[model samples]
Target: MIELPPTILQIILNFSIGLIVTVSLNIEVGFLNLPQFGRLLAVLSGAIVAAAVPGRILAASMGLPWDANYAYHLYNFGIVAKINNMLSENPGLSIGILVFTLVIVALIGGLIGYLSAYPALRLKEAYLGITLLAFGELLMNVAWNYDPLVGGTMGVWVVDPFRFVGAGGARFTFAALFIFFIAIAIYIYAELLARSPFGRTLKAVRDAEVAASVYGKDIVKIRTQTLIVGGSIAAIAGALWAFFTGSMKAATYTRLTWTFWPWAFMMLGGIGNNLGVLFGVFLYTVSRTAIILYKGTLSAVIPIDPEWLEYIMIGLVLVAVVLFRPQGIIPERPTLTLPEHKIEMISKKFNREEK
Candidate 1:
């Protein structure tokens, strides 16, 4: 097996998380027509809740000191005396705690979804974005003030699941597996939601709310439902991210870091198509990772920092897509109309949506 550089490995993980976030965003904004500026709020809430719960669960499971037990292990690795002391003292808090911790992360996603309905009141696109952005900032601010939540700026250390299992490189391996499962599940569910009756309703509302409402659709309830579903998926991504990183920090979930890039991915690929969103995620991830990896090469040739260049390229792409291909590279597909049972001459525009 060819071993990837550690930086490459980190990039892969980051890219996966970005893709997941983008897909979730597309489901909400592109399909359901929800105006979400604070998408990171759900992600952060899920991740933090997962981190918080799993640490405690692991502690409770193995009869250990919870978060402190992992610390003890870290110290124990540094010195034989500490190892023997911890073994002699705690004696049995092992890998099971890590598994328990991951479960907490999954549950955290559900919890965020459950709470998302409360914030469903803000429905306007720009307003929602501002609210979400504010929420992300608020989380960081809270972390700064409450040091114990994520160890303040220094950040908290989490038990590496693979490390607990005595595997040298399993951390990335497992993280990849975990992320793959999440992506697959999210893709499947989003697709289902896109194709279902409810999904159609969501699209109708997105395309023209007034028309949908006139045709016996409850806009508020549908929007709320979409928020709950999409937020839940995002929360799941957040939880998986927290576990994969084995550390959660306010900085990780900030607006610039988390929210903006993912949404850009969705826009770049195609707004309403699930596959398009996934493609967007892939494009963003590959391009972003490639630039960062070969930053020196670019800077030597071009007079801009790789980071700035990355943003510039992304912005330019967004502009090109908007002006030339506003529908997106693939474009939002027209909803299909099911055929009637009888052989009636059905040439009445056949529009799936009412508007």
Candidate 2:
């Protein structure tokens, strides 16, 4: 039996994947200044890729026929792959097929993000939110009805990516490593963007697009660029999650809950600052997991609805954040400092441009 600590650790690891999804969204909303809502699209894309790749591998190993809907579904969803292929002349080709699936999904998702920016750039607040919400609903509907996409309501079995390491290695170890590396990369990227010149432009666009335009900035182009980058990052996070969980289901990708939850995380943590997003994830994860576990224990003795309690807790936290600390716990601060060489170079460039 797995010990309590290890079990909790595993849960933390799994939750971290969710965190990546939230962080990716925060970059768009908080940093890039887009009122977007498309977390499901990215997560689904990654999950499907992760599922398909490893599923084919396991099915071939087990001697089960490929093209078996069950096997295909499992592989595509990132569930455990356990079947054989009848159509293929070579069974070994499954591995290659899996890689292809991931690439295709990522590209498709990136395209959607790029295209959406046209409309996203024009709308503000409520209108933009509505448009994105509609897009998310449309995607979810497609996932649900399209059997080929995710296996319908039954969902598909997804082959675990770590399984590629073989049965001998502990699965949890691989999961931890994947999460750690990806999380670190995201952190680095977030900080880099937060401190970069482009990042400053995003803030200007965020605060006042009209003013920014008067300053010779193209609001549409900057926002479009922000959307593209944020969308791409989200896709990468989804792909990583797919590898971690080994499955993608339509139910997993909805906007009302999954998408909005990240917004809450950003607002609670401190919007406009990456560090606040990180802090929010840490706080939310702990409260959520720990409370659920405690509630489970308490329910056996007294009687409490777990889901309702969580909802109530989340709502209260959200209200508190909005009422008191809208800027977020950490809040955005001024940290503008240019090095001597860069300052001189900028001064020379400005003088030359003027001349």
**Candidate 2 per-residue lDDT over residues 196-293, each given as its tens digit:** 98888888877887898999998778777777666666666666665555556767776755677878888888888888888887888787777777
lDDT, residue 137, candidate 2: 77
lDDT for each of the candidates? Answer: 0.67, 0.67
Candidate 2 residues lying further than 4 Å off, grouped into runs, are: 1-5, 52-106, 166-169, 300-303, 339-355
Which ranges in model 1 have alpha carbons more than 4 Å from their true place?
1-12, 66-116, 164-166, 337-355
What TM-score does structure 2 among the candidates reach? 0.80
Query: For residue 254, what is the lDDT in candidate 2?
Result: 66
lDDT of 1 at 211: 97
Error of 1 at 180 (Å): 1.7
- State the lDDT of candidate 1 residue by residue for 12-31, as single tens digits: 67667776787778878898
- Model 1 clash pairs are 37-128, 37-129, 38-132
User: TM-score for all predictions?
Assistant: 0.80, 0.80
